[model samples]
Target: MSATREDVGGTPLPPGWAQPAHQPDAFEISTTTFEQRATETMARPFARRAIANATDHAAALTTARFVGIDHDALRDKARQIRAHAIANLPDYLDQWIDAAEAHGTIVHYAADESEARRIVAQICRDEAVTRVVKSKSMASEEVSLNSALEAIGIDIYETDLGEFVVQAMGDRPGHVIAPILHRTKDEVHALFSTMAGRELPNEAEALTAFARDRLRHAFLTADAGISGGNFLIAETGEVLLVTNEGNGRLTTALPKIHIALVGIEKIVPRRRDLAVLLPLLTGHGTGQQITTYVTMVAGPRREQEPDGPERMHVVLLDAGRSALLGGEFEEALHCIRCGACQNVCPVYRQVGGHAYGWVYGGPIGAVLTPLFRGQVEGGELAHATTLCGACDDVCPVKIPLHDLLLGLRRRRDEEGCVPRSEQLAFALWGQVWSRPLLYRASTAVARGSLRVIARDGVLSAKAPLLRRWTAGRDLVVGRRRS
Candidate 1:
């Protein structure tokens, strides 16, 4: 649903604030069950095709980049770097704050999303910001900052083409890196044609030109720019942003006031870590040596700097991240957001990102969403994965994504968020497995029962509850002969 004027505050929302096509219950995943969301997303042929195409394209490019190279070693090294950084996050944060302050940058710490949103909104209000332009930042999305600022009549525009398309369509992003991955060229063209009052050509170049012309104007005329950092170097207090498109540079450079909203876990201890991170991130994210534009901000613009933001602010957002530190799930904080896990996940590939039903998606999202929001808010996300370990294998930071997901599922079960039927089923299965005689009897009974509903060699949905599993693929009972 779109953010209404009342939802924001009392002021009117800007144009294009209506609900989008694939609007998941972002705030409340329990509203519609995860199965319902996944089933709906799986029905979208275009979304599934787009995810498959993007995943295949990325895999091929990444393989090409790693030919005769020690990709595993690089992954290990990257993992170590991130692990070390997150382990000593407090020290790194302090060092970063001192360095950035020395460089004349204003730094603010937000313990939660509300504080983060308030800090940015206050910044805009203090600066009397009438118009704002932003780069794609998941941190900003986490806080719903656009709606907060827009509620107070601050007109905000997303500069990234995918983000712009998503914003224009008033929809949530399907994928992290490629927000509009679920959308096709024709869909975008239709959206543009509706806005332009002319039938825009359904072509890549034509769409690019149309978007470019419009965003270029937004870039040149916005009051303040907001961006998310891929890495925040503690040694130099620099915020590093990577983008395939050059819009990030434009967004940060053109605006007089630049505000960076980033998760606290983005910090690294040393400057040289960029060497390992940039290549690792780009390789895993898009199969490139590096993104086309890697903008590094030491702290706003220096005296000698010819062009950049005059005033820069970095909002260090610690919404449940600080609590995760030094804990069993702390490894999750090591993610570089390479999006490799999602690309390799079979479940994500088939259902697409929207099925996860939150800001972050895929296996990583399944882990992080519940981790951040607790079982009450995001427990269902834990069941979105297949526990296939593909995500763990492909993670550049070597985060044990499957393990973390299992942890979330365990936590959910312990917290009693899991349905009673699911718990009882598992308990009964456990009882059967623990006793040898019972196991054989249960297996015989299961096979006999399956034979009743069995068509060919596979079991069909004999009950309404069984339909969830049997809808996609049939379950087969193997022959008993050894």
Candidate 2:
């Protein structure tokens, strides 16, 4: 992918420019089809096991400590803030543009991934930069920025510990918050030893020290720093970087040039919004009052500052997101990347992120992949969820994730994206139900078929399509003729 370096200028698309396609036929299969298939096909059983072990199910079930804080009120406020920002996106974008410019930061807008990568590469070329340090930024991931930079022979180091581990292993992050959540201690020890060119202890502190020693050198020598913005404040042109690790601060401050890659929807109207969001994120995520670091950078170091970057750049990427702003999927933009949805997601809990075959996973991934990549490439992702309401309930912004998953399934079906076997099965069932006599006769036949398959009152036959349902559980067929 190449990045583009263009100014943000153009008429916004008409509201609902590309309505998400609807495919009613795709919903015939149960929502578990994709996840079930993924579980059987995934190559890394150790990774899946690691993820299951890391996320404590019983701990997640413990009641969140609201403690005089009104979760409902906070959610309402957050929703309003996101809704307002999206509604006036163009205006706030302009405000952000002006303020960033006023603060001596150059802002670039890219319409797609290639364009975005080209722009970043060009910036690196212009600066004659050979090395860069990066903070955790999903926008950079979205644009595949690291690969693009590496293609140009630029050494880019991911500073976040989890990101660093995944980068060293040449694996995409499995979880947004914990990129290395899928790897066990032994795997991490192996990866670290390989990367460090020596054996390192399997302890977390030792692994961290190894990464820190390696990255500290890069920080001092890097020509530029690249980061993903958690929240972009339109009122001040300030970008918020939230992290449990201190690397975000170091990367942004040490480099000569600091470039932030942010999606347009990340903008909030004011800084005060951070008050509610930061605590909520910490509490819901790792059960902390605050992360180790929360840096709000407005621009590069000024003439008076003793230590900071000399230049700053903010790239606003609108790769298929603006198109989703006012449509049925608009609520998706309200996502805070808290991973709460993923944490509680039954599908995600089972098969994990790679199974979705996309970057974003769980409820959010189901909604986003299809919308961002269009129905054909990403539409199949909708079938990964179990329509469980857990994701929606834990969402800090109150996005209706379950309903959106169902809607996407409906859209995919209408678009004829469903499998042929599924279509045939549902069609045959529909035909049978449409005729009362045939429906009764089919019921009778089904009963007879059940009797043939049943053993000791339980149907344990390993039928082709029904094998998945019966694999680990007993299914008892009703004997009543009705």
Candidate 3:
């Protein structure tokens, strides 16, 4: 997992990229198949309806928000900016490192997940940090940073309304933007009630106040704050964090020490690039013109400053990202973590994020899971989609999701990761299809067999060969009586 240092990362702070951080057993890989997981989620009608309604509404808002503008032109410009930043990533990182260090930010580099965990944990220990307040950070989830901090006997509180619920329930995030998209308000009410010892009101506003009251103590007493960066400005050496909640600002400003675990691919060449990138990010992610709180920090609190953390550290994490650079899959690096593709993906809407069995999900997840995790563990995810181009259409950075997914499928085959049974079936189909006579004969025989099995123009019962395929879908043979 050693990264190519020349291009992939910055210099380390200390105890350089070598400590073995604890890895959770079967961290993101599901114990069951995608079908099994999807079935389980589907069985929960509340969760299914919650996810569907939320996504459809978000997709609608996204369409409506961009109605008066040249949305395609904005997406194209954003794509170009992201493409340029990624293409010249190393140079931008070098400039950022120099500028950040000058601004009094201590920058650390982690080549992979284990190192990322080790780096942040070591920082906490070194600072003698006891309690920590945190904002939403997908990178932290990717490396399982909270688990690492807990292992060292530090108390960590998730301040974001949704993420706090996820942490309290010991559940993985269900969506990239809305971590609790699959959870209903009733479910949250129940959990909060149990926590309160007295039944709390089932209203959203009351529940929010309860969470705020509890988290305020954490903010005041915490020694450290941790967050993920939305964008890294290379020219000014600033970490840009956008959120609808004030937690991001509070998390960074209130704590004595602040640490940010940001992916290296998140870097942009200049602060001006945000003019092109931020609107697309906000519009596509939440369908808002802009996030409520936009915090940009170039360094820790200065001597003259009245607020902010005393010391700031930025951990530039590679974690399997640099491997994709200069390769066929590099375009994936251009993603802004908007989760727009997820909102429009039919498969994601059906099963939600958990079924993908990873930190990320939806069309981007299908491509990234196989690439970040190995094909042996995540290859099946590539086949989880219907090859629909809806994700491509909705992507803010214009990631060719369909092509990336297809590439993974092709790679899986080339690497012999696919099951032998499927290989044989496809091989047999290819052989027969190559011969026109055999193809015609096979189709005729299949049609004749189906007609016999058909009852009232439908194959109503599960048959031996097609049982799995027909379980949720109906196979209609002749014209309907109606």
Candidate 3 shows a clash count of 0
lDDT of 3: 0.87
Best by lDDT: 3
Clashes of each: 0, 20, 0
For model 1, the superposed segments whose C-alpha errors exceed 4 Å read 1-30, 435-441, 444-465, 474-482
**How accurate locally is residue 425 in candidate 3, as Cα lDDT from 0 to 100?**
99
**Model 3 / residue 84 / CA error / Å:** 0.8
How well is each residue in 155-227 modelled by candidate 2, as lDDT tens digits? 7778888887777666667787878877777887986675555688889899888778767877877889999
Could you tell me every candidate's TM-score relative to the true structure? Answer: 0.91, 0.85, 0.91
- Lowest lDDT sum, 10 consecutive residues, model 1, at 1-10
Q: Which stretches of candidate 3 lie above 4 Å from their native place?
A: 1-28, 435-437, 444-467, 473-482
Q: Which stretches of candidate 2 lie over 4 Å from their true place?
A: 1-37, 40-45, 57-63, 431-482
RMSD of each: 4.5, 9.4, 7.9
Flag clash pairs in model 3. Answer: none
Q: Give lDDT: candidate 1, residue 456.
A: 77
